[model samples]
Target: MFKLKRKIMSKLYTDIFDLATAKVYAVGRRSVWRDYFDLYFILKNNYIGLDESLLMTETRYGSVFSQKLFMEQLAYFGDIKDFSIEYGLGQKKIDLDEVKSYLLKVVKNYSQSHV
Candidate 1:
């Protein structure tokens, strides 16, 4: 039981970080739509602060995360529109454009503050 509890705790910590930190980092390097959706959901739900999330990401990944690259990826969603994936929050459906616009706003705010 102690071993099982430790395993669960380890996974829980990983999930908590992955929810925002890993997703945000992945968005900069890949066009995975799930990364964007997860980020939108995390931010909209107040799961974590963006600055804190980035800090955790940097802690985990060191200097691999570039703020410039992340901001650029967040702003560019042209290719994402061509790809489709089912998305929703609970029973309600979510639109891709809405996610894009919301994240764009977040990127804008983050950029302005960091600059």
Candidate 2:
């Protein structure tokens, strides 16, 4: 069972790395009672936060919104994957194609604004 799980995770990581618009920097596993993976990616100038950070479980279930924005507080924060895991909150599964589309849109918008 553990071997099968590892195989699935390897495939998922490869699929994420193959995305053209986003440059993946690191992929690592973290455990705090349960195991989860964190993928660090670079899209244009964004780093460590926003869409650049992704956290998901071994079964690949997590949030579509990687970051949280609070207008009243004028603050931004990383979405806690632990809550999602605990409460089964993120029903929408992670989709690589959708991620690619979103990253491409960000790149296009950034380029246009700067030029």
Candidate of highest lDDT: 1
**lDDT tens readout by residue for model 2, 1-115:** 9999999988875655443112221112222211221221333324233232333221232432222211111111133234223325764454444443554465455446546
Off by over 4 Å in 1: 1-14, 87-90
Between which residue pairs do clashes occur in model 1? none
lDDT of 1 by residue, 11-34 (tens): 986787777888889988988888
Off by over 4 Å in 2: 1-91
Tell me the TM-score of model 2: 0.25
lDDT of each: 0.83, 0.33
Question: What does the lDDT come to for candidate 1?
Answer: 0.83
Please name the candidate that would achieve the greatest TM-score relative to the true structure.
Answer: 1
TM-score of each: 0.78, 0.25
